[model samples]
Target: MAPRLLLVEDDLHSRTAITLFLGDAGYAVDPCPDFASALRHLQNAQNDVPDYAAVLTDYNLGHRDLTGLSVCQAMRRTSNRKAPIIASSSEMKYWEEVADVFKLNLVPKLRHQWDGPAILAKLEEIGIKP
Candidate 1:
């Protein structure tokens, strides 16, 4: 079976693009438009193992109170702790502050550019085969 991935992105365009890109690259992506949905999926895992092989989340979730950071933290607490959690955001400064502390790999989401290569590279660097 293709490796499963959890994609938490609030922007519809980005979500669709990423889901398609990863899907084409042989991953079964579970796309979530917001934190609530992502949380539900994470919490619904039937076993101690995570359903996803990796998680790619956007830092700015169109919400002031919560960001992808919240999702990453929540994932850490779940059985999915072993899975890689990747953070993507244009907000570099904000992520630089907490990424290392949270043990997350940040992939900069460039403006008007599809960062599929960078995302794929990070996934490989972390030992997650496509």
Candidate 2:
């Protein structure tokens, strides 16, 4: 089966971009905008949706919205602790805040370029083999 991925990001452009590319990379991507809805999907996965192999979230979904740390917490509470969450942020300080808090692979977000390649590299590092 193809690897299932939960992609949580607030930006519409970023979400669409990643979803399009990762889908092209052979990953079945489920895109969510916030933590509550994302958790809802995780808690109640249907037969059509495959089990999530990993999670990709933005450090900040929006103003006072779904943060990566919150996503990590929900995943741990709902499922086992084996879920690997990868988050990225343009601000180093923001990414550093949640770096040691959970089992996350935090990637740096650059301003000029997109975060897709860094994400693909991390996915590869985790033996996703996609």
How many clashes in each candidate? 0, 0
Q: lDDT: which candidate is best? A: 1
Q: What is the per-residue lDDT of model 1 for residues 1-130, given as tens digits with 9 covering 90 to 100?
A: 8888899999999999989998898888999989999888888763553478888998888898889888988888887777788888887777788977788888888893338989888888988876
Off by over 4 Å in 2: 46-50, 112-114
How does model 2 score by TM-score?
0.87
Query: Which pairs clash (backbone N, Cα, C closer than 3 Å) in model 2?
Result: none
Residue 37 lDDT, candidate 2, scale 0-100: 78
Model 1: weakest 10-residue lDDT segment is 43-52
Please name the candidate that would achieve the greatest TM-score relative to the true structure.
Answer: 1
